[model samples]
Target: MRGGFCSGGLLLLLLIAPAGAAGTERADRLAFEVPPGMAPAAVAGDETFQGGFTCRSDAGENSAGTTACRSWISPVLPLFVFRLAWHVDSVTAERVVTGIWIGRDGASEPLQEMSGLELRMAVPIENAGFELIDMDFDGHLDMRIVAGGTAGPNVLYRNWLWSVDEERFVDSAALDEIVSPEFDPETREIVSRWRSSAAEGGVDVYAWNDGVPVIVHREVDRFDGPARCIRTFYDRIDEELRETGTGSCG
Candidate 1:
């Protein structure tokens, strides 16, 4: 009688297993399926791997006779896989990213999407489309998307931080607005450099304050004349940036 009872219990559990799994699959599907209008541009082709993510792309010409491409990548996160999608335009043979989508990995549906982003290089989508880093000194990896860049190697990124409480990525407008930000994980500072011309530029060092960036120091360099240049130093005092000293441009 005990053996028969055990067999009945096992059969009941097996009978309910598929229904439970189906419910979970449906919930996930409703939560993270591809956005409606973007379904037509879904990437359909062979898959490739880039920067630890599986990627795919679909290319075609738009109405303007320019090559338009849609690409997506699946990057594994701590508890989930991050799926990213973007649009690219090839004009004069230069590809530029114009839109982006953030989604869960298993399905190609986007939970968030942005369009009309600043022009950024499109190919090598791993580096240009997205970046995973520890931005807030938190051990968890954060996210960044290429916003724009100069002709030089000065690339700018739109930053997003992973929120432990929220269990999702939250946008960091302060970090995103930094000019040519370079992260120093060791020093835990954000260094930014910008130039208006070949002879005019400045460097700013910032430290995180209450999850925001506050400028701590700066060095300005510009030509005073065709041959003479000046280098000025500034330090933060009482939340103000004050010139500390000046020297010859180095």
Candidate 2:
């Protein structure tokens, strides 16, 4: 059988955004040892680092986006923490975030100084954070950050897949474009749902090919009339999404 719809694609964003922001706030206040032996110290040059820390760009000042926030990623091997630094664009005045440092416990310096960062603007800044998940189901955690403003229900993410052999994170533009993405380990597929309007939306199923996501199937639903809705199905053939059939809206 093919993959089915997630309970609610957009719901995940609404639930996760606030939780992550709150968790960061709590971690910033509390002083606790993470990964057991790591001595508490200031991270990213913030002086008050007790355990977990959050650094913010001064709201009153017009300096570049120089705020850095630290959060410990859960359930990662060779446990480490990542710091996301925000810089304000001089002309646009938008706050942009990029991965700056990745450090393990007991390390004097960071394990890696992240590079090739795709700058993404986080409007509210508070909702700006990072999540570590295995994007390709390769048993390695990858980084995904809130890429843009969340005024709309459809939230977008900037993705970085972890490369085990290379010992670094590689950015995936294809994965970043998938909205409200969900991974199915059983089928080894990625599912994305999009809403164009209240009456128009669609679902896209993607398969990984050579470390990139390619659309394999698509389902579109839209209202035809006052009370009528139509569902269209498309299959990817020869690298194109071709309409194959139609049916009543499910």
Query: Cα miss at 75, model 1 (Å)?
Result: 15
Question: Could you say which candidate leads in TM-score?
Answer: 2
CA lDDT of every candidate: 0.54, 0.59
Q: Where does candidate 2 have its weakest 10-residue lDDT segment?
A: 8-17
Residue 186's C-alpha lDDT in candidate 2? Answer: 60
Clashing pairs in 1: 33-109, 34-109
For 144-244, candidate 2 gives per-residue lDDT tens digits of: 77776333456678888878777777778888788878777567788888887777777889988888899998888888776897878888888798988
Residue-level lDDT for 153 in candidate 2: 54
TM-score of structure candidate 1:
0.61
Model 2, residue 146: displacement in angstroms? Answer: 1.4
**Which one is best on lDDT?**
2
